[model samples]
Target: MSVTDTEATGRAPGGGAGPEPAVLTRRLRLVLVLLLTTQFMLAVDFAILNVALPVIGRGLGFPLAHLQWIGTSFALCAAGFTLLFGRVADLFGRRRLFLGGLVVLGVSSLVGGLAQSPGMLIVARVCQGLATAAVTPAALSLMTTSFPEGPLRRKALGLNGALMSSGFTTGAVLGGVLTDLLSWRWAFFINVPVALAVLVIAPRVIEESRPEKRPELDVPGAVSVTLGLLAVVFGLTQAGEQGWSSPGALLSLVAGVVLLVVFYFVERKVAAPLVPLGVLGKRSVAWGNVAGLFAFATFTSLVFPLTLYLQDVLGFSALVAGLSLGFLGLGTVTGGVTASRVIGRFGTRTTLLLGGSLQAVFTAALVCLGADRSWMWLMLFAGFAGGIGNMLAIVGFMVTATSGLADHEQGLATGLATMTQQVGITLGTPVMSAAATTAMTGSGAVAVLGGLKGAIGVNAALVLLGVLSSALFLRDDRPAALRASRRSGHGRSARRKGGGRFRPVA
Candidate 1:
């Protein structure tokens, strides 16, 4: 039998063992459940603390200037460490790193729950970010490896995307309820039990896979990229607070750009680069990542300003604000579930264009809201539309980005995509914040409303840019070899199923 035939038969070359029995299917389901649970927990942490921020600031006596750091700290650490951990996953086992990350996440949550000062909380949040850095890429790699590329993979990816989008919106609502009924501390504490459960179950349920050959960690490349991203994110954030022309902010921004340029060159020369240049060479992958980054950035900006607007301008309680954001989650779920169908009918290009255009329209509408506007339903609709856009754009982008990669490179591909998202959020948040603040120079509610409008307008424009990039740069053609390989693999499997006769099953 040919190599393809062996693979098709789902047996060893010597036919030593056949496929597992029905009991293994049950085990596979359990594995999927555990993985999804961990993913949900990670996603929730990304947004859960947003709803609790005001309360945390009030409780800890954090100044307005420093309040943003509560979120930034986590985001920055996660962004900084993602690439490094991706490399680590390539060296060590992804499962080992994933389980270890869960432990760190649980422990950090416990510490964060007990934090008495903003400093300690920031440290704990950073730790949680580090844990996430490890968990997310590994989880994605695991998913790709466990499920073969086809309808099964598409379904899994769609569900994963839904979990991710829903987690953010759900976090806001849950954070509010937890903060109001219990304490803001519970927001952090809640992760303890969830993380514990994931840690215990993941090892047994999730299959362990290692890189084909252990790859050397590109320490210098990692450091340079980390510093570059950190510098840029810090500068943007400072510009929001210290003025865009400030010497400190300008210098940081310039330095970040230079460092990133250097890092790019370094990747080209390194034997085992942090991110393979070949991956970026693929136009679909490159454009897809860029679209994902911009879309996510718009989202990052929307969350902070919207939360503030509800509380400060509309006088909504945290819980009410959180509940309002649930519309976004519902929309996200709707989009995620429906995207595969949309893609099947319309292809990725049209789906992205439509999603992006709708998102831009709704995001712009958010700017028109006011204290007297009793259009709560309008707010919900806008959020839902934006969620739909996000789901279509994100899932399409991811599918395109890693479309033709080898199984071993899956971790690296997932890492680069995730890193882009973090960078987008890091950059987008501060820029939008600054825009809003600048728009609200006066003290009245009208001034606040104006500033928020400006911010939302900026986000809308960014979404439009993402749409243009996707439409212009993303290619529609699948590599002919990849398509052939898939067809051959499927044919061989069918033949094997018929006991060496080319009889079709089902």
Candidate 2:
């Protein structure tokens, strides 16, 4: 059957109605491209400004204290509203939210590019971030639901995860190139065309989707979660840059913990929870997220040790050290491109185990590549292996986590998955730095390299915990919605077939 004909006949992709694998549709391919671009855009913007921060501050005369806002403004808002916007998409329509987010993003980019003042630029950045928060999971959920649960879906997701994973690394390089070649403003201005192009193509290719029953916003849960997450993220960033014991960081961390605890209880009682607490109990979702968190934490943290080793020990210039990260970027995209096939061969459990094991071994191997060895060869090898392992684990976890969720809940699923990841990367840098500091008890190159090796070793050991966790806990199941709506219990036949427990999905 022709793809358009199937759509006309009302066979939804990955819905209860299901998509047929054999049909290749032009519209579907375009939709996937548009959605993957959206993911890459969201990922890239995060780091695009890193290299341009000095210029931005000088251009707009931002005070030293306020300079960090260039990055934090967008990130904090994106992190805070991601889950809420995901729920918003489910309740309304994913396409509707996605398009609206595009408008916001494009507008914000334009404003940011033209900004005459720091406040204006910051405001634009926040808006851009909010738009990213709105679009990221909405687009992802749209893509996931539009593809069937076989090779096609895996391929699309693997690519999405790849672009998303490498977005930051790519941005770091692109930021330098653009800033040196053109101007820092190009970073913000560049997004405008991408958004415009996506806007032009999206409606023709993508379909709209929302829950059958409209859902009400859980205001309490939303407010608490946003504040709680923002605080936690801010604290982590502060700790990473400053110190764990910094008063501001400690206070924010404490406040975040309290708010999250309150949010947990608040969710249980809310008539319509932002995240159905039971969703956390889903073994696939829980363990997949846990695995992703650990994998990302280890992979990102390695950057610190590697960067330090390259510069301090090898006496490379800043540009050379930065260029060396190309290997990591190469591996990340390579892994993303290959993740699906690996998963296909090994299954989610086996793939995750392999990823964790590789990450551990690669991280530990860094310890032996001291001043005596060729830093270039060892670093490249570590980056290649780390990137492969991290991306492979990411693909497995993403597929597993979203498995069995009701069609509408896919946004929430993606949001949670993304949130866990942001938190891990946020916390990882500080933890790694602290570990390195503790390891260096003496003075000179011996002490510094010793600390570097010690930190890498410790990080490697920590990764093993995630491996063990996945081995013990990661498993798959048919979502409760496969048979019935656990919330309404309305379908008499579905209810009879599916009680509280989920059956296995083939």
Candidate 3:
């Protein structure tokens, strides 16, 4: 089947639904499993090496500073390639691209597992990042097409979001355990089996899907945007090591902005823009992504700093520190699972408002925590609040952004949403990290507390701003009949398979 036909039929590209009687359903289930597994692997891979940093540094004979590159390389490549791969998925075939990524990821993981030098490891990681760039959008697009709209899609998407969140914390814990018991290499080695399984099963279960009408690839636009994002993120990362006033940092920042401006003009004139200007014109898409960036930024910052505080201040082992992050994951899962139900009753807008407000409140509360204080309960509460807020914002944004688009535009929509989230995390992390560093410049417990306070305060303000933007700017004025239809569709699906089966199409 052609890519467009496969996409239209809700089957992933390159994979044919078996006999007509039960093929699509069976294949879809298989595809779903593979997609989720790949996502989990990608998410875990992003953070797994963090806990093993010390071991990796000592074994590899690298300085502590250079060790950060292991993570940064992956992040940079992943961010840079997201749109490129996303467009590829739209033009070629999502399933084909997704499978290809799985192959690259598997090979990279193997290479990383057996790396004899830091350079080799970094190269492997970059390849893995490229693979991730392909897998994420394809997985999301598959989800978009596989399930019909309403509660089933919402629950599925919510679960998918929760799993992705959990994978980060899980990676840290798993990394620590593996590094201590087996070897740091196990972190990468683990992906081999997972990737192999996904590759083997995806073809049987997932339907291939692509745009009915393929748009021209915006190569120039893609390159400019990628370079622009890289420059900005690199500049931010550099500011931590070198002073913010450093010439290199300033130049990178300026160049990034300039390239992005050029990209805007390119998009405006292109027949088939990499990112359709109309997508950005929609308030829902714009605000949703903006909110996502801040939310993810807050999340990344919280985990990193808190991990350090637990180890340095609380004198916890890596394992203990990792375990502490479970609270955040737990909260995210709880929030994600419950968001669909809440949205069903309260309306998407109201739920988003509640989520944003709650997140802001909790983030502000986190600012009160001290180095010496055991704020376990408070931390859990805050984590829970943040999780709920993050999930709500993501789901709301995704649903709202794609609501008006045709099937052909689904890949672009997913890509745009993913890009914004990535950009938010990329830009927000260094800024928050800088805030923490600035706060803790002096060498005292008081200094550390002050820094933590500043970091949390900044995050809280961002959350508040996100809430305000969503509340004021996002509008869903579908007629009551349409809303009722959505609810009915969602309710029927929910009843068919408990509370966890809804999938919102628009």
Highest lDDT model number? 2
In TM-score terms, which candidate is top? Answer: 2
What C-alpha lDDT, on a 0 to 100 scale, does residue 236 get in candidate 3? 66
Report the C-alpha lDDT of model 3 over 1-506, residue by residue, as the tens digit. 22243433443444344222222344455556666777777888878998898898898887877987898888877877787777788888988988999899999999998998899999999999888888888788777766545565566677777778778889889999999999999999999988887777677666667756677789889999989888877776676557578888799889989998999999999998888788878776677677677667777667766776676666678788788778888877887788767766665666667777777887788877766647666776787777777777666666665556655666777777677666666667677777788777677666776777788788888888888887788775444755786777856766577666655558
TM-score pick, better of 1 and 3: 3
Alpha-carbon shift of residue 101 in model 1 (angstroms) = 0.8
Estimate the TM-score of every prediction.
Answer: 0.85, 0.89, 0.88
The TM-score of candidate 3 is 0.88
Question: In candidate 1, which residue ranges exceed 4 Å CA deviation?
Answer: 1-25, 57-67, 116-119, 367-371, 441-443, 477-506
**lDDT tens string, model 1, 1-506?**
11221233233434244452222255556656777788888888888887678889999888877888887788777887787786677678888988999899999999999999988998999999999999988887777656555444555666777788789778878887888789999999999999888777776656566765687888789989889877887787677668788998899999999999999999999999988888888887788888889877887568877877787788887777888777888888888888766765555667778788888999988877867648676788899988888888777776766667766677887888778777776777678878887788788777787888888888999899999988788865444544574667965775678887765339
lDDT of each structure?
0.78, 0.82, 0.75
The TM-score of predicted model 1 comes to 0.85
Looking at candidate 2, what is the lDDT of residue 470? Answer: 93
Give the alpha carbon lDDT tens digit for every residue of 180-238 in model 2: 88999999999999999999988876778787779789999999999999999898888
Q: What lDDT score is found at residue 409 in candidate 3?
A: 64
RMSD in angstroms, all models?
Answer: 6.8, 8.1, 5.9
Worst 10 residues of 3 by lDDT: 15-24
